[model samples]
Target: GGLVHYVTWPGSSRLLVSDPAALKHILLTNQRNFPRPRQQMSLLRKVVGANSLLATEGDTHRAARQRLNPHFRFANVSLVFPIFVETAHRLVDRWSKLIDADAAGGGAAIIDVHPELSHFTLDVIGLSGFGYDFDALASAGNPVTDAVNSLLTPLSLFVLLRSAIPALNALPLASLRKEKEARATVRGTVAKIVRKRMEQASEPVEK
Candidate 1:
């Protein structure tokens, strides 16, 4: 119905229009012409991967989506149901222990469930998607979990600075330094896993 202009950075205008026709035209018809901002894509690539769908465009984006769509289908997802249930049970067991520990220490102890849930979700992703047990909920200070947390942490002020002045990313801030370290850790861990998988695959099948 109306156009809204937001000044995300100095001397720049980001538009948000409430017109359905305009939205449809931009999102559906002219999407290729209006790709994600280069800075946003570059930042996302560092977190996800160089070949990540979030950072890809045009034919590469289409090909990646097409390849991933089958594995993400409801039917395919159903195949991981057992893994999901097992993870869920593991989460419950961990929580039960926490509650028991609290009860033994005091009558009623306040607990923060956010980190527990975060670890549970990460464990689920590791087991189901990568066939690696992160065991984040079962153990504290898991390197993979710590790496992911460091990389994906939301820095509100840093985000605004990065978005407004893309060059700020080059500055060696504490958050940026931590992110670099986390990325290295993730790369090393994934490389090790990939090498192991390759070695296993090359082994002769047990007859």
Candidate 2:
């Protein structure tokens, strides 16, 4: 079979598309003909919100892209490169502190860099995307950090099953309730930050 082929299971099948040209055609050139699957959209919409660019389709997605295009242009994106550099330096400093503390205790430094890297990523996103400082590396326990952690934490087996079988989502699960609360927190925090930015933009500049 070619790069594009179908994989079949007992009750369902999926088209596996790997060719770059075909991917472009499906995702950009002729996207309208290849709508995302309802289940895929439902899963994504839970995390990104229904109106987000990743969740929307057709005209809504196009309009959102148009609105965001200017800010994403290479020239504009380059302006945030310094933010990445600064955040990376902070990560290094944090690691150094950990190593020094370990040495002081006569113990080898055995740091798990995974959570540190995740915190670095969140800090970068907060600074570059929202002009807000999460300071995730310096501390923890903030509302935004807590909410994001809740959302990104590993899913329980029941939740995973629910995601794979949408019918299972209807069952009352405490994990699902926590997920709903986390989503609300994330959306509310983002809306508050965006509103603050808009207010600042509208204020008159002092000479």
Model 2 Cα lDDT, one tens digit per residue, 125-198: 89999899988899858777777777666656665566679888676778778788889988998899999999
lDDT of 1 by residue, 177-203 (tens): 888889998888878877887898899
> In lDDT terms, which candidate is top?
2
Q: Using TM-score as the measure, which candidate wins? A: 2
| TM-score to native of every candidate shown | 0.73, 0.76
